[model samples]
Target: MKKTMKTTTPITKTLAAAGLAGILMISASGLPSAHVHAETKAAASTNRVTAPTVAPQLVTSKTLQSKEKWLETNIKIPVFQGLTDTKYQDQLNDIIESHASKDMDKWEKEAAEAAANAQKNGYTMHPYQLTINYELTSDGKDDSLISLKVITEGIGMNNGDPRVDTYNFTNEVEAQRVTLEDLFGKDYKSIVDKAVKTAIAADQDQYFANEDGFQSIDAEQSFYVADGKAYIVFQKYSIAPGSTGTPEFAIKLPGKGSDKKPAAAVVKSGAYYKDKNGKIMVQVSVLRQLQFNVKWNGKSKTTEISKGAVWSAVKLNKDAYTLGKMAPRSLGSAPVMKKGHIYVPLAFLTDVLNLNADHSKHGQITVTAAK
Candidate 1:
């Protein structure tokens, strides 16, 4: 018969041995090599019995490989007409290594530390990139006019998930000849700032209210001093469906100057009204326009009332009481109205009425009544 005994190495025993060895190493500099080897072997044996060692190298390697492949396949570089092939290739390589390297942990850590340091030093990071190209035509005289086509690809990485966005724009630039300075000059910052500001302002104007009621709305307004053009926007409540009343628009113009008011023009277009089935039915040749109307009490009223305006009013479940000229309009579905005032669509006011619309900061609306 063979006898067997279960054996175990406790943490306390191992810790004790390590402590003893450490004390010995510190107290006795002349410890024998044989004794040190014996202690090391014993510690290894105890560690094996107590806890198994885990190696994470394989997992890290696999993850790194997958990320590398993803970057190689997804990353793209635009080849402009003026760029040399070698220079473009070099740039592509640099971008890949800097942005999506396999051994990026160190770089990422360094970048994070640098960013923290910058924040500590009272500096903010505004990361951005843009690419544009265009053609120039001239008869060899004064400054040539440039027809530019711009394509923008931007990434905003905050926290973890990155927001990737793209846009296309076309414009004209004035320059003497085809030079690098012409492409990017002293006015580059101003031009870029103006363009970006315009886009941000437009986006701000397209905002919608999240909460109900008459909260304060703030928006951006633009005016052409020479052309006598002005724009204003406000946020208000939407008219309720099936409600019969007048829809009011409160618009804020650039100035109180009389010349800034829109020209009195009468325009007509087809209008649509919702049927019992809630489907919009088109009403043709319903002339709609905006003009000044005089009330019985001798009050001047600028009314946007037309067949189309009537359709807008009725679809919004409101009554049309004013008449005006027809203009190109993009009307959004009326929101649920609150109180007695019906909020107009920002798009309708901006696109059709040529007013600046902004609901980004606060809710605002401008109402025009006969004065």
Candidate 2:
């Protein structure tokens, strides 16, 4: 995590998209910023639960920059490489494609405009550069998480400090990308809101303006993972002007909410159930608690959630689905709707949300965030 800056600027009103020569800027409003349930710790302890074992890493670094008299572009994009598993390697590449090779086109163009305009004003624009970096937050068989950071500086022409944009990703199931909504369950919005405000309240001196000075977490904030924790990220000048530098708060899953004992099968469903295939299937009601929604118009049904993000269950056969294109999935049995309730495979949800479901010897099933 990058350190927050000290010098502060009071944000009176929303800054305009106004720009200076060769300076491309976005207002602070749009910025970066999820949850999970845990299996019973009592059972997990007996099962010997622990963080996923770290695996060997594959690294690939690319430096692309061009410097001229008036305009300059420097970018450092490093992604994981040397993946032995082609499935995962391809997954990494796809993510980078969306972040850098594709996203940079607009940034680069903005830089050029800033340079050309600055030169016309008899000023040599600050050498504009942006760095795209990837940090390995967590490594695992079920949950491998990565954080991507893109920093742009020198162009803003203010304190000349760089603005930060962080994005987090989990390499899982080959086809599907895990989202925060999937991990923490459906109430992530409120969960994050409480968590962030709580952090800000603890260190009120660190921020400016009112008690609600900081905006609530958005759906698409960039975050990173490290040491089995998820850091909700923010850019410099975003929440507390430049003083806060970049703000990151590790989300604390409340683990409070019904805390209902895992559900049973014969009862026809309310929480989780042991499926006919002997797999635990989480009830949609709990999915609702987790922030996952299942919408039906009486024709087909759709499931949506944020587990790290817009995870949609696609390719429905019977019990099998792609689990939203990020996961390679085959259901133990197709999900079924019984008496207005929907059921999903526990294994599938655990993988998508980056959680671990432990079956204890005492006939208990515990689901917790993957650590």
Candidate 3:
């Protein structure tokens, strides 16, 4: 019989939940071999005994600070114990440490430049900051496998871009890096491509135009496994606006997506036309297919769509819409009354519902779920 296992917990989420601020980065010893098989044999019988788990440890480095440059650094590097092959462990640590050091050096110079510029220009500046943190996402039983993320964040400098490096290793005589193909087979790209497109289509407002923003995952794309699922990660602003930060797409492989079926497609059509601003305006009734209850208050000249606890109301001829308890945001275009029926922008309505529009196929619009 075949067997597979993976586990991980991202520390960023934990810190965020605790209301801790600042970003993280990691460094390691060296790079290991580039080849690692994804499969391992199970015991002959289910009753076979197993040994106690030997987990990896996090070793904190001495905090480094430069008062003149207004910069400070903090890092936590990983160390593996009791492994027959410690080469990979050491190399992983090296990689994390090296990355953190390089980043700090680069940011330190930039911070100094910013400080001089601020002094010359007679202005105050925020102090430069750097932090490196790691998330030990998963360690297979008996130390068969190890997976983790090296998170790096820089602040108050010239383009302190956030970065995450994923490392997957096999605890054997020789350590090897795990590739996407090893995790999901040869058709990995197709699976990831579909998920990426689906995600962008679902959240159109968050991403730039698809044609220019993202095409597909590269052969050496960064990824990590956690909680029985794999996540494909893109750098900040690579596929979306800066507000989106780093974009991640979660995909379940055969062991993942096989059990659950895709959501049924919902199709609906209404008279649509390009407005003066070139926005697609459709009949308000189309929202019904999205499971939104539309109501019109003739006296107040308002239209409201409610679904459970989430509700949005917009006044006729107004370019603002109230979503639940949040402040009003622009609808881009105001809803208008045409022949006693309400018409709204297709983009606005679909965005509010968190769905995507597909005009590639039939004349009708097909809505799909987003991340």
Highest TM-score scorer = 3
- For residue 98, give model 2's deviation from the true position in Å: 6.0
lDDT of 2 by residue, 1-371 (tens): 11111222222221111000111111221122211112221110111112233333544445544333333444544444543335655554555444444334555566677878988999867655544433333443323344334444444433445544444433322222334564465555666677677667666666665754776777655554444445566665666665455566765332324242112211123356676679776553344333343333234554434343445563223655554565455756666665444567776656555556666665555554455
Runs in model 3 deviating more than 4 A are 1-69, 256-371
**Mind giving the per-residue lDDT tens digits that candidate 3 earns over 1-371?**
11121233322221100001112122221111111112111111112111122233322222334444467665554444544346545655455555555666777778788888899999998878877665555554312345666667777765667766766654434444555655554456776677677766666666789476888887667766555456566767677777766666656644443453233233335467778988877766445433355665656877677756768887778888667887777767998877655778876656775667777455666555464
Identify the runs in model 1 with alpha carbons over 4 angstroms from their true place. Answer: 1-88, 102-158, 163-184, 205-371
Per-residue lDDT of model 1, residues 15-125, tens digit only: 100000111111101100111111112210111111112122100100111222111122222221221123432343243233333223333344456566667999874
TM-score list, all predictions:
0.18, 0.49, 0.52
Give the worst 10-residue stretch by lDDT in candidate 1. 14-23
**lDDT, candidates in the order shown:** 0.22, 0.45, 0.55
Considering lDDT, which of the candidate structures 1 and 3 is the better prediction for this target? Answer: 3
Q: How close is candidate 1 to the true structure, as a TM-score?
A: 0.18
The better candidate by lDDT, 1 or 2, is 2
By lDDT: ranked, best first: 3, 2, 1
* lDDT agreement of model 1 with the native: 0.22
